[model samples]
Target: MGSLCFNDGVQDDRQPWWKAATFYQVYPASFKDSNDDGWGDLPGLISKVDYLHGLGVDCIWVSPIFESPQKDMGYDVSDYQKIYAPYGTIEDVDALIQTCHERGMKLILDLVVNHTSAEHEWFQESRSSRTNPKRDWYIWKPPRYDAGGNRQPPTNWRGYFAGSTWTWDEHTQEYYLHLYASEQPDLNWENAETREAIYEETMRFWLRRGVDGFRIDTVNKYSKRTEYIDAAVTDKNSPYQAAPEMWCNGPRIHEFIREINQVLAPFSAVSVGELSNTPDPKQVLPYVSTRARELDMVFEFSVIRLGNGDLFTGKYIYKPFTLSQLKALTEKWQCFIEGTDSWATVFCENHDNGRAVSRFGDTSTPELWRASARTIALWQATLTGTLFLYQGQELGMTNMPASWDISHYQDVEAVNFFAEAVASRNEQRIQATKHGLSILARDHARLPFRWNEDDNVGFTTDSAKSWMRIPREKGISVESQLGDRTSVLEFYREMLRLRKRFQGVFVFGTHTLLDRENESTWAYIKEGFLTTKDGHRMRGRALVVMNFTVERAPLVDVSAALGCAPESTRLMVTTACGAVRGAKDELSAWEGRIYCDFGPEICI
Candidate 1:
């Protein structure tokens, strides 16, 4: 290995696969359909290896595909080691993994270990009798009795999907804990036998089968407080309560992760934990710290919180995510992780949230919509971490159709909120709530990946009824944008290609937030060195300046730091093509650019 210019011009060189890779997330059920079943299966995904390769991503992070009761759409795992029947057989999954490797793309599966489907064999046996050998595999406590001898739930904790966290088990005469749906029972990580069994049967099982890595689902909620305490009631009538302090990043979370990491280390497996709602950067560092032996990185929700209108309520409210807010959150993470062994996952949208273009972009006009997509791409691609692009993101997908009825929404979160709102019988509130949800629903991203402008948006045969409605009228199909010079898809392709061309500057350069107090504009500088194969070296500075708002903003000068006149800097990439100007040129609405003192050729 040669020297990494960002670390030094001569000696330090450590190239972890994840550190240099760009990740693409695919919601398996919405990617493709080979047999016209209206549902995407492993074979359907296997058939799209070329398309993924063409997109220039280094790896694909697939959502859960385990055998499930479909209670939570595959999150409720009945058998951790088996593939869902509708998705395909174990052989089909092996084939998909093999195909991705053959195409030079690594595959990362979703690891849902926090809970298992109530229909799981282990759960069934545990619920049968108190003397069952597997009785301790899940949480179970005797019901609390009131003065009148009336039975009550063990605790007043609320389920994430609504209702009480504890469900009465008549047969066993006890109450079981479920943080999610009642069909999903929380696994007892406290049991040494349970943890070891999961490691052997699930973790090592997939690693032995050539899995590249895993995206641990709900990882922050894995370890609950040993004492089952009632969460303080904030709203008595609301089905859910605020209890993150008791469960998130709990006592043994770091210990559990370190043990899991020990198992993954031998296989060279990478992992990223879904740890949302952890506000303190200090609190989040341990999960991804090299010294901690936990995860490669963890997904933080600071940016997501800004886009999510209702932080406390179910993202059922609409609040505009402003330019200033985006800057403060991103800069904090970037600065915090710099020079540390820990890392951050830079992404704007995924299966759990609406499209970034819909949440942050000006979708009211076609040019602004496209430009917003480009602006987001520029921001993510040049960030100091692994980049993740959800399916259809490259094509600049918009929110689901405004005309879509609540009936068309398929996400459990949206459905539950709608049902609860309707029960209130307030027409004004119902209309207002639904209106906000129209822009924030998770289904907006869960819709089928648009491959072409066919009758079914090229996801399936025209006659096949899709599992979820496709917004065909959006006209944002991959095929239509594949070769269009100015299309969002092409813009992404260019950004990715440039990242590969200048990996050191983008991946290892020291990050510095510029114009920290600016409200209308957000800017950052990445300074590092570029080395060539012939051993020639050039000091490089990459400047990312953006007008995040909808109004033109005057540019500022950074020529002294750039070591050259700002006007002389090379424009490596930009949402709008024009002369390189660092002093007087005003950025157009929603416009951004990547400026480098030295050209990308210096890295080569």
Candidate 2:
């Protein structure tokens, strides 16, 4: 929440607050629990304002806390205006908003308009009868009859949580579409009434409550291919087909986004869309482009999908990826955003993704774990975009231990996938699926936040069991790392501080990836200009080098990478222990360093 002074010791009013801000994503259920109800609530988050403020985060994006069945962990909203009872009341949220702003921070709720819970009044009314006026509010289609005279779903497209995308409604004698879980029915954006209701009831209702903006959930899935044709079979094991093209970024996506933008413009709000299934930068540009006037930025999944399997298996089936591949995908986005009006959102871990340290860092040994965690922190902090840090990421929290069985997972996606795998009755398949889930399951990120090494990791009191499994791991808690200079949490603080110190270079600079083919190293240079207080302009560049392997990495020429002399560069920060002797000929295992040549006066 602290002001970011870019150049000349003056805050850059030209840039939007979000353009250079660091956002912290709080999974309400896992963040903290103050009521001792085994679930985290708004009051618990309110208690941590000082913690977030100290971490240098400017905005907090809380994943869905609306009234829900919690079938999808709050993503399935039963009521837009009401707060989930377990999380807290509307009054608690108002207090949270006030608490955040009182400390100079902003709060943005998760806008999940793509779907509503089956128990929602709107969906209940829509399904009451075929002639109901709200029947068109959701995507409802008559079941198709097969040649054998058996009823089938409207189409053969698979739902995101597995099974057919359409669920049969016996009362209405029709099938309703749900891109995700059957409990979450997709809204028909083609209906003007539905769109307007979302804008007025869901969006405006919160904006009027002083909420900054929204992190739009499934932003690109608002529109769907109305043809209702069968999708091509991408996964032969399943009867339904995996067709993102049929549901993601469909015909009317931009129109819907423009309409939402109009709603946000009056409030001067910022939006970061969760744009899925559109990996191509060209496809992503329209949503975030200033000329398009859609969203402020977007969360693209190309880099996150590096080691993921096919669309159907997704992260549940993991594949190995080289550092070169990660560098290429990252640079592709970084280069694509340069000079364009469109902006980017940089993140590794999120509510749906596995822990960043487990996925991107070496967690085999304690030493490697801390080093790799710090290395990933440096990598993310130096990227040319708005940085989003997931809860517990700063403390190097990792995925649950491999010994944990399928019962530990509370995520609907993981539970469904495991059931399907077990139903297959193939031991090989079940074991492989379980192994993959251990490495990449969404449940890993949903574990209760480790506040300390207390019972239930200090997420709640010992009398109340956490809603989800608390990891048995030790030492990766806020209390444990609070003042330890060598801890991953401390490294994150230093990295964020350095990022603020060189905001001009880190935020507005041009990103250039170096050693494109290097498998053991990831290096990039950020170049920009900063003006001194006395009206003197100085050019600055930062060279970031990271060793992504457990083995020592080959030497990287610091001077050649940044096109500056070695003497002019200063060792800004490093993950390696002891004082670094300028630029070394070789980097130790899992080492990361940042070198800047912005002059002594400005670098400090």
Candidate 3:
């Protein structure tokens, strides 16, 4: 195969190991439970290493496993070095890492350095006295007093969890900043000592434990320009809303990331920043740019933003996104990041969003469920980046049952949003509001893993309860899908194997969208040129076509588009439904196919 450098002249066909890897995100709490404690532990995760190995995952990204007060579900880290007791001890983490290595899989832990639990020893000392050495470790400012001596928050900024970004502390007579929950105080990255301590305690410590890397949470929020400025108000009713522009990708963000990168370079570790606040890929490029020496990649969220709605109403009250929109978004990122040292982290589902099938595809019936699952999975794997598959994704999991009420929700973000929406009744009508909240809740993804069809769906013993209610979806368990030849799990295995077989084309090839303007049909071409075993140059191409709707969509006539007859395209991977034959053939709802062909038959 011919080797080519990206347009930027820095990235070539030769990429890092992570660039060709497939990742599985395990939300530890809901992954699996051992010891009947109603919570998932490291031991539970260690036992599943084989399961992951069989799933063809190159890496497992375990969500935050640090010590905390359980507020914000472990994002609020009290101790950077200790594992949360419910999860297990440090030795368990070591064992898990070693086990993953033995299984030929890498482990990447969640790094929540943007904020620390208020109960952290440093925060405790900082609040104890104004003169404390650790006082500057957290963002602290004096309250703004009115003429009548009434105190207001230091800044008119709301946190991600709602309410003020600053919390008043009577002992220190000041307010500390928290971009997220008040219990999770933002760390002062401006302080050299604070940054150094984080390196030694979190990054270095974990690297020494033999962990591969980290998924840095809220990484773009690490640096904030020094100012007590009030953010522009789009909604007068919520004037103090958290200002992402002022804090996200702040002036020193790249510098700090480079510093962290330098420390990680020696260990040969990789990091993907959770650039949650960055809505534009342009804003994210620098952080992952090879020239910047920062993160290896960053999570771009344009696709997820499609399902979201008004800030107050959340993602539930939204219009359906079209295939054109998905195509445009993916191509936009692919075009921008193709040649640069920067890479993309592509995923359609995670612990924070509703299940992909429920949110992006029709799941009202069994056939639609599988088709929808396969379509999204095929599209994700064919993209030009690292692929992250959330647990149960391969099993074609749907969202929480529509009948579940507020009591069944477990994620703090969803639960708090429900209460806040109800309390702020004037914002919208009550009944319609509750319906939307239930559909958009994050708990839909946090439910326990469905292992089999049993009393607890095989998540736990009959006598043992789960930390959160486990919603039962018949035939969606691993046990049910394991041996089924046409099941979603098998489909995923085939997709992965095919990807591995055509790694050069899928991972390093040039990506081109063929039907950017078509709403019902999304098609793309991935092609690469490589040297054959006998030293002859060969070109391989994979044409991916999908029907994003339930109704049959007319097959796109690629004869004119690609200058190749439809009969010449060989079916590679597809849904259980057979491939289309003629130029005007139609596809079943959610049906898709990847056709393998040789040469420059398809235009790049």
Candidate 4:
């Protein structure tokens, strides 16, 4: 193939290695249990390096494995340098890194510096006394008293988990802020010394240990609004209010990210920020733009947040959405990043989301399950960005059985929400909340990996129990689908291979959404230039079509849209079974296809 060319004065050849790489996110707790301790550890992850290498992944992003009290899992870090005992020792991490490097794959760790466990030494010292030198390291305020002399939290802002963002400390007679759980107190970025300490302890500590980079958690929430004012009550039913403006995309977020970039620049580390709070493309561009010198890329949550209710209710109340809505949200991001120096992170499932096959596709039948999984994979693989595949997703994993009760949930977010529902004593509200949780709870993705049809699904010894409940879905394990040519696992492997083969078109080509109004069909064309071995340059156009519904759908004539004859288009890949005679006029249920047309050699 020929080299990629741009209309402006940009060179695709100069792109960073990460920009062209595929990432696989490993959520350690449920990945694999090497010691049969019911929890996945670093050693177990190390043993699976070869499996990821075989999957065509170029990078591995492991979620938090740091020493913690496990209040919010490992998100509440108590020791930045020490490894979580359940996950394993530092030696295991070294082995995992060396193993990944041997196979030419990079490794990134989750950075959760926005807050630390209240048990952290710094927090312990800071809360000991108001005069302690470390008191300023965390955000703290004096409690406000009402007319009746009852002490109240400084502000009416609600925490991400629930309740007020502040927790009163009787020892210091002051309230400290925590945007998340109270045990996870928010760090004060206003303190220069605090910022310096976090950088030295977290970022530099790992970079020196040979880790490639970081997946910064809540990256935009580090710099928060300093004014300690009450958030206007948007939901009057609740005492506290959602305050994204006060704590998200704060005044100093860019400055903080620039400092982080400086620390990462020396190591040439890649930074993919979790910018959940900042959804606007214009607002997020500076963080990832080449000229801005901030993050390399950031994960946007708009697509994931679709079909969800308000912030307080969150995903507890499901709202029906159309394919047009999905298409518009996707196109918005794709077009926003086209000409800009910034990049995007293409993903449908993660540690915090329900399985893609269950949420976005049909799972009413076995055939539809596999087809929809392949369709979703095709859609993500063809997008212009870094791809991240969560574990078990390649096997078309679905959510936990809807019949399971709240006792099976181990996630703090889900358990807390359920507790609130039960506390209300409203049976109707309780039933609705439980039904919603069955569909959208984060615990759905926290189940043990299904390796085979053994007890505990081969995640652990047959005699041992896994950390979370294993799904009862049949014929969805790796061992079952590994040898099947038409299985979801095989389709993922094939799709990823094709993506790597045509990186120029799939990763850097211009994207144009076709038939944006269609609710059942998603069609888009990617146009770019490819070079031949004999030094001739040719323009290449790739058309991707997907039937997003569970029924047959007629797609737009992409050949006519691209001004190319039907016979000239070559069938590159398809999820359809059996032999495809020629160009297709309509797609079968959940079918996806890609066609490539390389016109006669042309010079720009």
Candidate 5:
């Protein structure tokens, strides 16, 4: 496909754009508590710049810092131009921007454009008088009529949080839409003014402030399935769709994204959509593609590796992907974006995702967290794109309070789903099954970072309790693990160093897969490294292999296809620190192996 593959072969001249960049994601609320108020503020984050740089990251991706009423932990933004009072002030944000740029690093804010807080001035005016100039800024309609004039939501489609997508306003006697929570009203992108206001002002506000990029929350939700046609009522207890094809990749999605991209082009800003429900490869392709108007990259949730269990349907499910299943998810996306400037942002855990350490392997102990984290880090980082590391992920922090009962829980979605299932389905006591909904709800994963064994896991400063309870420890603590080179944190530190060293291969390499039949392992190779910012003067090969099973799972011969004989390749890094590094046809369990085809007994 032209010299875009470049000379050295690792990076594409088609897009030498992303070589040597690494992104670290921060959940501002739990990153650091600079103030003693028990809340994590911007100043708290400022204190950790050195720590981030020390990890050798090229960029930092911070979660929402906008002004919000916080019904959804700052996701429901009240003011696009304002920072949440709890996060810190405008001065604190400026300090962060200046600090990051000075360190030669870029900062990307989490942009919540799918909707705004109900308290936003736009929504306030929309709800005031039906004839207000901004009334059309948000979707509003007359309530659905049953037998009497008594009203119901306009549609059967449920909000992500639960219940009807429409909310009633007393002042105008009309219904307003909320795809997520009632407090976060959906913006009517169909309105040119609304789109322009959000695009121009939001970009200018941050771009002028020196922010580098953004992680657009629910990127596909902007246009809605827009005919506003009634969603077929299926799954009586299910308020939403098992899959909403019409809603996710809507008609005007590309048009809206292009409008935003034009604003971002001059600044070289990186914008990745937090794409959800993109079950089809073709539908998922355009958003991250380089072919036309789309984003620089899109974050994929393949690593979440969710279980198939239908707790709501009374079916117990377990999820362990076959070798081809994972290869399909990771490689399909990789191949789709190969020719485009649009790229994929690779990650495992984030603020809303469950802890990868626990989800991938046993969370029974902190050491296991380390093993799982190391294995996962080693694998995803080897892919062809930018890297994303979530907060506390390096420490291998796990899912919150494993024993958390219904009384201690606070996730809105978790609670609402349980109530919905009970009220609508009459399922066998769903309230009692609130524990089941916790398995998939966003809250199960978004707890505070655990820094110390001391009060509040050192997440908060004052006597106040943390936003979410920290998971109990069985030998995991940053203070305790910092000095241990063999700890998970150190492993992550080294992994970053290694990937940085091989930036050309991991970031710019031509992507291809080896074996597809192996059920319990993940395998791939990055070949033909190209010249990057640094001169690449030689030929080389890099292979990534991960043992998905905790038990030993043999890998198919990937070296044979890449021109490496079994005897010629050398085994490099191992997830298990103390284990002897070797080149057996099969890998030991949960261990990841990176190989180089230098020669027999290849030199390190």
Candidate 6:
């Protein structure tokens, strides 16, 4: 509701659109099939830009597009300079980047620098013989000679996909390490030559092509175990374990990030790392410091781990957080990042997780979709950072059909988690792990982007087969709702409009978290978007309340509460329950609403 201004200090001028960007992620293989092939590719993605642009997303983050073995669904990059044949080539990538830029949109690639495919030329060469020049490019150790003169693995550390993290290479007579699948061997980041080469190639490849930014995968693990540490000794005789700390954010981590940042700085390219530790502001600041290191922001994993109270308990987690936990986690991160050089990468879902609509709140009802979405966006954009939107999110995509059962799951994480559970012989944990795997797997988020409720959900061929199944109907689709003013697609458009309109608040605003919540309310405030030093000319202040319930909660009237300008106390907007004929109303079972007024103060 407050008056806004760009850095020019004139309330009359507007800020650049990117200051309030909304990013949407695309998992290419399962998104759309252009030539009627079984897998989705870049050309198919080109056809969908209109849909994304129509939804008002400013940036599109496509999952790993580099040439790969598909062991981790393109994450196991074999060639940073080349493109995956199935996804298309360098020209297709160039066209995709150009198309997005022409529409005033930005593109961020999923950077998987933590490891490389064993099939890559470097790995192939490294494994050929112990004396190979590239032998030190990856982690490797001699096999432990047994009493019988047979060879044994150097350690029992298990690979995430199935067995040991180390696979013996008979040709080289050494064991090569892989944190994920055996095909994705971990790179020896400690090696100056190896790390430098990767940084040089990866940076030079995209920056030269005019791409916007990167979403670093397993971002914290760039620096890894020189000791090749052993597993944590869990039950089921589990052998795979590397306290990522032993590797994550290691001694040379900052050095590598600084180097990458050097190459990216000239391009104004943004980088956001997927972080999974405690949100200690000091620890997180350098990576995003304008003056320091790697990324522009960090996407903390606490939100995704919300429902899982105790991961080590081996529990089956299939629930969502209450309005309380949601508000708290968001508030904590908001506070920390605002005070530090770091910015936050806001999110509820991404390529490796399930959709937020189904997970955060009930979307079975239409009203819920609008309310929850608006509530989510209000909180996200108002934070001191950028935001990410996984594909189909604008249309309010939910989790994949639960009816498919375990046999249908094809994601490596899902398959591996299932196997890991089975190997433990803990039936209860097995049940829990399987269900948890479904929610946590890439497959859940990889469902075809439903352009309409067409056969294959407008993704794969009717006669041809998709590597994965498409989502079932929920009345939520792009085609049916594209032109409808009362649809979720349009809701997103309005959200982006509002965010861009208040760019300063959504970008550099100082955040203050509301302390409490009932089942109905999630509240917070953004204060410094317009300040005296910035030549403040705002009509009033901004306080936002995202009510996740239908029952109206008690309010803290700004006129009577914080004692600011009364004129600004007038309601700026309602995410739902508005007055006009087409105005949206009461959220679905778990839908939400954002109410804004005066030099505002929210009633937590």
Q: Rate the local accuracy (lDDT) of all candidates.
A: 0.81, 0.87, 0.79, 0.85, 0.71, 0.69
For model 6, state the Cα shift of residue 210 in Å. 2.1
For each candidate in turn, the TM-score is 0.95, 0.97, 0.94, 0.96, 0.89, 0.88
Candidate 4 lDDT, tens digit per residue, 1-604?
2355432334556668887789999999999899888998999898888888887889999999999999887999999999999899999989988999998899999999999999999999999999999999999999888999999999999887878889999889999999889999999998999999999999998999999999999999988888889998787777788998998888898999999999999999999999876768889899989999999999998898776666564557667789999999988887788778788888888998778888899888998888889899899999888888999899999998877888989888888877777877989778877877877888888888888887778788843467787767788998999869889998899988877666767776778998889888999988765555455555678999999887788867767866788888777888977752123678888899988886434222
| Residue 118 alpha-carbon offset, candidate 3, angstroms | 0.8
For model 1, the superposed segments whose C-alpha errors exceed 4 Å read 1-5, 8-13, 147-149, 309-314, 426-429, 558-563, 577-584
Sorting all predicted structures by lDDT, with the top scorer first, yields: 2, 4, 1, 3, 5, 6
- Model 3 lDDT per residue over 1-604, tens place: 2433232222345567788789999988888778787888889888888988998899999998999998988999999999999899999998998898987889999999988999999999999999999999999999998799999987787666667788889887899998878898989999999999999999999998899999988888888979878887755766476477778889898889999998899999989888875767678788878888889988877886676666433434555667788788888877777666677777888887788888778888898888888888888888777888999898888887888776777666766666666776755645545676555667778888888888687666752578887776688989988978678888888888766656667766778998588888888888765444444456666788888886788876655444567676677766745442223376777888777665333222
Question: lDDT (0-100) at residue 375 of candidate 2?
Answer: 90
- Model 6, CA-based lDDT: 0.69
Q: After superposition, how far is residue 4 of candidate 2 from its true place, in Å?
A: 8.9
Q: Score candidate 5 by lDDT.
A: 0.71
lDDT of 1 by residue, 4-39 (tens): 455444333555778768899989889998888788
lDDT score, residue 289, model 3?
Answer: 86
TM-score between model 5 and native:
0.89
What's model 4's lDDT at 100? 92
Question: Residue 171 lDDT in model 4?
Answer: 89
Candidate 3 clash total?
A: 4
The Cα error of candidate 3 at residue 480, in Å, is 0.5
Q: Taking the tens digit of each residue's C-alpha lDDT, what string does model 2 give over 1-604?
A: 2333343233456678898889999999989999888899999999998999999999999999999998999999999999999899999999999999999899999999999999999999999998999999999999989999999998999888888899999998999999999999999999999999999999999999999999999999999989989988777777888888998989998999999999999999889999888878889999999999999999999887666677575546678888898999888888787767778888999988788889999899988898899899999998888999999999999999877778888889989887887888988778877887888888989888999987688888852577887767778999999999999999999889877777778876778888899888888998876655555557688899988888777767778777778887787888887653223687888898888776656632
**What TM-score does candidate 1 get on C-alpha atoms?**
0.95
